[model samples]
Target: MSNKVILVVLDGLNYQVARDCMGYLNGLIEQKKATLYPIQCELPSMSRPLYECILTGVPPVLSGIVNNQIVRLSNEESIFSLAKSQGKVTAAAAYHWVSELYNRAPYDAVRDRFTDDETLNIQHGRFYHWDHYPDEALFLDAESLRQQFNPDFLLIHPMNIDDAGHKHGLDSRQYRNSARAADIYLSNYISTWVDAGYQVMVTSDHGMNDDLSHGGILPEEREVPLFVIGDTFTHAETTVKQTELCGLCCQLLGLEHCKPYAPEMIAL
Candidate 1:
């Protein structure tokens, strides 16, 4: 595709929060020349399972990643491994447990375990913990990893918003504030990468309710946003609901041979 891609996941963030913070994100969207969508996440909508689905492009049934704390490994498949085989370098920066699940060669730079509070800051208008390992550290780490290994794909997960939402509620002022802060970081990150000529695909694994509870049968838990902006992709206002976002990623990367679960693939 001739474009490096970065996938940014804002944990537990909903459309409302993102829309409210659109002013911050819109600039990055314009700078990167990207598009936005409201994509659907899988049921239960927990972090580990949903992220696995996103990276592996397979559902829990096939990927064997059904929960947040468990690891499912089979000899035959892994998106990171497969991407490596295809000569694409892949890198990721995620919260503790999710990073462990995707430990593979091509996907480098997995962050060690950090508590939710340690990685996030809800006070002062919600910003990432820049004291220990700033957001720039992760971005620079990804950039360095890419420079050394030249990975074709990069995935980043920021957990402050999600953690705050879980502890407080999605409707809580804390959560919204966190979302706004996340938007600022995201915009800055996107601006930096897209300026470096990388296509940015921003999405989430799933959504959380106003009360910050998921893993249940609720539309709020399953609906998420999937937006793309880059030189390689087209821009359009389209909706892809209840569809597995993993498959969409595969399609965009021209790796559609990956097997996705039923109801995981939807057309916009």
Candidate 2:
């Protein structure tokens, strides 16, 4: 089986918002017959740290990526580096802080100096707003990248719904509209990839509260959805918490020896 994986990060996406789109997603799930896991996101439920954890299979304490602004390197190497060592092709495209922290020019400079034949593409763009409707351009760009690179691993980050929720509270019409927009865009992307025979994994960095704010360890902010769709996946529901997701991705990608956070359930 080709261990191709696509990771999609929906920035600031709450479980409730995902639930709202569940009808659409459920149909896709049935059509694709993919596995679904409800995973808890990281603590503080912020962006940078959560992405770091997903990329490295280690917590912020070990990855030294604790927030959205600053980064410090810990001993743990990222999954990107690990994939490179295994001769697996990898590609990434993201918006906002997650992309910024990982694809910093200085970091890229150093990586380029040592790595060849490894493909990493990071596109920067603004979050949601009519002004950025063309932001869907990123998806088109990513599709082009996928065709060109045919990477074993691919990551895409979409940020508008989260941006809207943060600015206008989760219940606002704007937030709802943004959520709907995200659903449309995501559905299109996943369906396209599924037709192309790629296994797609979708999740969020962390969730937001009804008030559209979070930096706490609350369940509303930490609970996120994890869904896997493709021929490679077996359709079933598994209760997977956030920390366990990194390891699960590694497993799905044929890196069975990779270490993952021990599964632990937090009371809702």
Look at candidate 1 and tell me the lDDT of residue 115: 18
Residue-level lDDT of model 2, residues 1-268, one tens digit each, is: 5577788877777777677755667676667555456677766577778887777767776667777666544345555656666677776656534434444433443333222243432322222222243437656656766787777777777677677778887667776677667667776678778777677877888877777787688777887777677765555444665666666556666664556633231101
All candidates: TM-score: 0.75, 0.81
Tens-place lDDT digits, model 1, residues 107-220? 233223321121211000111232234444555555555455454666677776777778777678877887777666666566667667676777777667766677765766
Worst 10 residues of 1 by lDDT: 118-127
Q: After superposition, how far is residue 10 of candidate 1 from its true place, in Å?
A: 1.4
Q: lDDT winner among the candidates?
A: 2
Q: Which stretches of candidate 2 lie over 4 Å from their true place?
A: 30-32, 72-75, 99-135, 261-268
Q: Quantify all predictions' global Cα lDDT against the true fold.
A: 0.58, 0.63
| Candidate 1 displacement at residue 228 in angstroms | 0.8
